[model samples]
Target: MNDMDKTRLRINRSLILQEVRIEHVRDFLYQEGIISEEDMDRCGNVTKTPRERIACLLDLLPRRGPEAYKAFCSGLQETYPWVVEKLNSTPIPETQTKTLSSTVLPNKEMNTGETSERQRIREPYTELNHTVIKIVTRSEALNKYKDVVRALGVPQPDIDQIEYANFRDLQEQFYQCLLKWQSREGRNATVVRLIEVLREEDYNSVADKLDGYID
Candidate 1:
């Protein structure tokens, strides 16, 4: 795949809308000079909701420049390592060029507070990150994510959006639900808590499976 296709393929649009703090993404991209101040304002002001802003941002990235894709990944890696992980996992075709030309942008250091905020967002992912991945993958197969999420009290609108986004693929729908929960809960999205929710949803077998990872 070429850069543009690779860019679109790597970014899980629905997951981004659900999980990413778009403000941080915007700031990072702006600092990298991938997006201009006017672009930033349009992304924020043209869209009312967080989801809309992220969607708008994603739409803007491909058209920004060739380096936009790489810069986007760099910014995401700082605050959303899992997102970068997912993006990197996308398979590139053998025909694709191995060497991508890098364009050096102007140096604009992120301020102390912006740096701190990225650090804060990254901390929660350090623990239980792998476990959450395993659980989401395994739970998707079990097809019980809907029950678990509903029992965990995901808002109806979020649930509706999840259904709408991945209508044809049940597994993807489940994955989206877990991401929604994780994004919404942040540090509170613990493996123990997920297990509890599963059991409460009467999926003890699933809960037991997840419990094994804790030990």
Candidate 2:
């Protein structure tokens, strides 16, 4: 089997799906015109867990053709706008620390004389320095990284094979693409962080490596 075939594997796919809420998906599909009200009634039954319902829908939708499949992904993006937003956005450079001028603080919190929660938090801000950060969401991380590929200028067709892929398969592809594009002209903090992720390293360790990049 070829590399793309390997990415289509269903192994461990449910690990991600098990965490999703099916109604959110059904609502999105319906809203996007991917499924009809009648279709929802038939497929949205509570008898199945959210994952199971989605599994069933996953099987059924593709039978309707590629256009329907694209609609499903679009609906999924709507169902979880946060995931899509994270992937779509560009990562800002790290290592610069400047205080929020209290302008950014909510008016009530401004006078509290604190850094204002995360506006002062150390850990999350530090990790942002690593351009090769792992996504917090487990199920969507591969696609989130796939979004990085979109930014990287050229995505091989294997990327498309995972458009509607289940989690584990996409996870495999995520690393594969990252490996192909990895810069070889000596490693920097960002590249190191990417290496850590490719090695399945934990985020905190990766974050610390990233912090070292701070200027």
Candidate 3:
């Protein structure tokens, strides 16, 4: 096969491997009388590389036609819709950095410290959102930001913690953090609300994605 064909096949097999454990596929083949236990043991060895395991499964499929393999893949799609959706989504490239500070942050000269801090905040645009204003109260998007505060020595917030305030004030506090890391200006004097935003974040980088921030 050509290089493009080989890449596509590798991607396909990787996605397949995510949801179809070797044992399940082997058991199906064995129960179907398509492969003997000995054949499975030889071909479906767990120690083998992923490509090899997938190739072994392919060998077990009907050699006479592609229909059997197609049916098997179709069954996987029917059974695991989420896996199928993940497979269909485009894979993120390691080299790409999805930044939004240009569009999200207003155009104005920033101090050296703010610029340096902003430079550290790298992320994939798809996963990172700047919706502090629009996000619903129930949304867990800011969970990590809350965790950051807790790590900095704030106690764990009590469950169902009620801090009654006007909805507009809440939005303003959130915006202050998104625009500036602090939230003092966003609240009424009698009703100070605390909010947090992070910069210099892996919440922007692949490493940040793999290990997460605060690692």
Candidate 4:
């Protein structure tokens, strides 16, 4: 890849991590033979989280022969139109911050501290209550609820109780766990905090994605 192409990917890394449905992109690349089966498997399983998986794939792509960049852009079109748009547009100057602030904030200058504070204030970008419950429950359908709840620091006894209460339905078990956490945390249960805990547990993909759910 050329310097500009590499720069483009770097600039859009967070947006890709946040907005793109990675599974779809992976499949598209695999079908086109841009990435081999082994490459796909490693990206899916060897990586601990979605964030890691995306990073892994991005790392692999730049070396997958000359067609890699073109194939990646094509794949993005299927599930990440905005990413495609950004990639096609002018690259952000390398001297700029290259964070999502460029996309959310207007074209203007600000000191680093002010930018960080305002961005923090805008964080989590999503409503906490029922929306979080829905997001976790829906996203974790194929994952083990017990592990997720444990990672979230739910007490083992509470986890056991929830398992017993919803033994037949994993989604319900996860749903109940989030509800319990929300109840206990009360106003402190912000999406930002939830994301922080998830990242601490190495659920970086989930944490990275939380902000993209703004709607």
Superior by lDDT: candidate 1 or candidate 4: 4
Q: Compared with the true structure, what per-residue lDDT tens digits does model 2 show for residues 47-115?
A: 867777767665545333224534544665755665334323423223211223343456456447555
Arrange candidates by lDDT, highest first: which order? 4, 1, 2, 3
Per-residue alpha-carbon lDDT of candidate 4 for residues 90-177, written as tens digits (9 for 90 to 100): 5568555455456445424333344455555564453367766677677633275554444344555576678798878878888888
- lDDT, model 1: 0.63
Residue 74's lDDT in candidate 4? 94
Residue-level lDDT for 126 in candidate 3: 19
Clashing pairs in 4: none
How far does residue 87 in candidate 3 sit from its true spot (Å)?
8.1
Question: How well is each residue in 69-98 modelled by candidate 1, as lDDT tens digits?
Answer: 677778888789897787777665444433
* Ranking according to TM-score, highest score first: 4, 1, 2, 3
Q: Between candidates 2 and 4, name the one with more favorable TM-score.
A: 4
lDDT of each: 0.63, 0.44, 0.38, 0.66
- Misplaced by over 4 Å in model 4 are 92-215
